[model samples]
Target chain A: MSNPFQIPEQEQHELDQLGAELRDAMPEVSLSEDFHEHLAAKIENSWSIRSAFQNNRMIRMAAGLLVMTLAAAPVAAWVGIWPQQKKNPPAIGFEIPEEVNVDESGGALGDSEDNQVTGPNDEFEAVEWSPQRRVALERYNRLVTAVASYELHGQDMELARFEGFSDQSAWASASEESLWLEFARRCAQADLSPLSAELVARCTLMLAAPLDRNASKQQRAAYAAWAWLLEGEQAKAADLQMNWPSAPFLTQN
Target chain B: MSPSSDDLLTRFAAGDPAAFDELVASLGPRLKGYFLRQGAQSSTAEDLVQNVFVRLLQNASRYQASGRLDAFCLRIARNLWIDHRRRGGRVFSSEEAFDRADPRPGPVQEADSGDRAVHLRSALDHLDADTRELLELAVLQQLPYREVSVILEIPVGTVKSRVYYSLRKLREQLHNLGPQEDLS
Candidate 1:
């Protein structure tokens, strides 16, 4: 295509002469002799200010990471101690079903006469606690604590605690399936009827685990509805609730 | 050979203070002329120039070597001008302020060439703002059409057409002023 800005050869020459005449007619304006010096000083001052700002940003980032790591250290230690502490003689009334036992040998434990057992105790002795299993248990316990804390308190403390355990470097060796199963078991064992928005959210994320092939459609829908409600997607949650296949087990806030 | 403006900008970006000095020296007059021609007072032009350089330094890291530094600098100057306008500051008209007080006689005027210069300045004042700016960029500043396009954020074709019409109008004004008196 021809250049749009181009003019005919003769007109171009005339325009050039006009340009030259205009340039000649224009008054000459020069900057002060110290113009360059003043400009350089201003540039240097600005550069220093910008450098300080960037340095401040990097320092703030480093400090934030440090604060986060320090805050997470104790929770990480608590999670690490959980699996070992659970290995003591099974709490008196804690019982494990045949199919879902997590003991090292994968054997089912005898049923307990009392069903009021509380706290972190090994109800089952069937599956051996491998290093991987220990890490998974740690994650499970951390998430459970996070959910419980969020329900009792508010989002901020719970989020900090969750972020603590969910830090990638801390749980690098744990398998997601193991942690997921533990989360599911913890949720199932707890009475979810008094559910908080926080617990509902945790349930939604945990239920998304691929390992739970046995969960009924109603259970999935219920979890999904709760997730939607907690996420402020009230309309979607209401729609799902209206078409629910069965009555939801969890209480809606 | 002198370094290209882009080269100087790249050096400045790389933290060479002297390169910044080189840039200021090279582009300072043109920038001042731009502000003056656009009707800024000499002091205001100087202040605007300082502001432009300050902005350039602050945003140096964002400058891409592949881009035109001249256009970039002019864009900053234009934005500052717009901001000044928004703040409700008066922009003096260079052509209307025909009797600008200066110690030095304007470079183009010899002992007897003042009338032609006055006529040209008066003619320039009559053009609309956009047309005058287009003429300033294409003719007085001598920027390439492409660079003008970037600075004004317009198509080169538009710049060309506008320049053509602006020059035609200016030529008519100059012709109507009749012949210049003999300069011999």
Candidate 2:
């Protein structure tokens, strides 16, 4: 009911004085022509090194792929550990069987380029590249990776398969989950709205979607809380306040 | 007419060092002022200003014309400052360098000037990097928070909050340390 940021009148006065002082403390600098030449030369030297290091296309693409994989892996595992279940029950639309195969059969298409699983929505196509679509795909990938990492195999493998991303070949493995988490966290923390927003959206979707038996009850609940936050459902988020194992780092608490 | 900053960057990337000279001519003063406002000594600020432009030359190919030119330059400058700070050469103590060591006209040395400047500099030093950078960009350089956010890799909301908090802190410190102002 009360505003937390209400500064007292006295404090406000103090702040005004500080502002005036701040205005006066700033320094003045003037650049000369000779200094500019020296700087240019230094930069030229650094560029030569950078060019030498990243000159090849294969190296660059490989590096990009490595970063993507590392970033996506922990997310897959986290998703794997989370629970899932079909929403709307069997009452609304056709419910796919819970035991659909992810890798070999046409289930959630195991992390391969060939397979494409059809979702409940008849019109919903596979991941596309528009801003919204990219966001959606990134979310899906992250959720799949997190769930997969946590041990939800089917959906994990399914989402990966659908997205044509492989845990084994794509540079994301059990060992690299920590690195991926770091990358994702750093990227999300920075003002990369497209990346962070997608992370939020996918996190929401993963939370909103029903969880399966293998998924971590606490992680699923946390995802649900995360989803609730994304949906502006703070009340529901408050309700799912379970003591999740992925407590400290994952929730940003 | 001399090439614009953007034009020089493009030409420099195309291997024309002369274009780089034009860029340095155009952006040098602005760069120098940015470092100075962040409390660098004039000579030190000038050095870093030159370093920023040279760093730009190395990374010229990375510059996209569609991107914010000023923000790009500022980001490079911020990185250079961080590096200089990390070298353990420049810290809060370096604030005195700005006030006392610059070659140009600096803060007036009235009876209260030294104390006032010292208090303000210390307050800024106490602020977070994001807050300090935003204040430098927004207040000192007169840039909008939008561009500051881009350069600092923070959201506009964050930029606003940081500037507000840093300013609040600075003002509080100033009032505590400087001559009292009438609050009528």
Candidate 3:
């Protein structure tokens, strides 16, 4: 008995014939004789460069040392270990007044005369960086690095790096409007002078206020135009501007 | 060839130059064929294959032997093509202009049975980009349906159905063109 699922012999023959024809028709490509030599040379060159980079450990060590020295300078000055020079005055330590009442916001709430006290107090009330704030700052740095990496590498690498860090989930989970606004505020506060103009523009555009609810069609179009401009798609941005003349972002110089 | 692809890849990752050479020998033709069939120029296909190898060398540590190397390499090729299209400002539309822009000579036009070959080429090209890709992966690459699904990022069922329909479409197009040219 023949199997019900089997293709008819004629149909199978035709398909087999088609496959044969296709195989014949398909072009056979081969690398040139020198291709392997060229690839091997490239690999060698890459290896040499990589080895050179690895061997230059002294430069990295020097950089680390410089950072450490810079970091310790303030501590040395604070501890009065550095000798006073004509240009650089000796650091003076401050003593917190014992009678001063400090508010939760770190504001002095008592008279200066009543608060006058000698020597540094271990219990001095000051606005210390909270753990949450520290984490936020770290996450912000990672976000900036991630964005830069995305620009330099590509989306897949960026996504992989992002997946390695859990803090990114918080940003992703947040509302887009709030996230953009927060990013804008942070970008404004950041020293973005070191970043390229394109990155600065990306940060700026990311921070751009989302279209207001009940906004006109022109406003929405303008926002999109600004977004495209930020993303370096000048042609699309120009088209949007042309179509939506009333867009406020387009009007801005 | 004694060791599997996974073994070769693992050795390649360990910086075994011989293993790398072995991989290059094994994968080079397949990669070149895939790119050429996908309408890349010979030079561009060579460049793409080189890039894939370079990427593999760089990201060797990230490879998991459990995952098929062919699928991984094909995915990279696909990504490179996508990036190439994006950089050229070629937006995806019904008719992919980039595929048509490929300057390389397509399927052996000078074959003995020229009309049939030409008709088959036209039919193959006429299929939608996805269908064409499916055929390339399933038929031309001769990848198993499971591996094809992995490369295409679709379910095995979808692969089977899509491949069936794509083949049916190709057959129908051939039938419409004229009687099948006898293979014998």
Best by lDDT: 1
- Model 3 docking grade: incorrect
Question: Across the candidates, what are chain A's individual TM-scores?
Answer: 0.23, 0.20, 0.19
TM-score of every candidate relative to the true structure: 0.52, 0.43, 0.47
The candidate with the higher lDDT, 2 or 3, is 3
Quote the chain B TM-score of every prediction: 0.84, 0.71, 0.78
lDDT of 3 by residue, A153-217 (tens): 33232213221113443443344334333323322232122323343334344436555677555
Compose the digit string of candidate 1's lDDT tens values, residues B55-115: 8766776677654677778889989988987888667878533235244554245424656
> If you assessed candidate 2 against the hidden native complex, which CAPRI class would it receive?
acceptable
If the candidates were sorted by their DockQ against the true structure, best first, what order would they fall in?
A: 1, 2, 3
Rate residue A4 of model 3 by lDDT: 81
On lDDT, the stronger of 1 and 3 is: 1
DockQ of each candidate, alpha-carbon based = 0.30, 0.28, 0.12
Give the TM-score ranking, best first.
1, 3, 2
Q: Is the docking of candidate 1 incorrect, acceptable, medium or high quality?
A: acceptable
Tell me how far the alpha carbon of residue B21 in candidate 3 is from the true structure, in angstroms, after superposition.
Answer: 1.5
Clashing pairs in 3: none
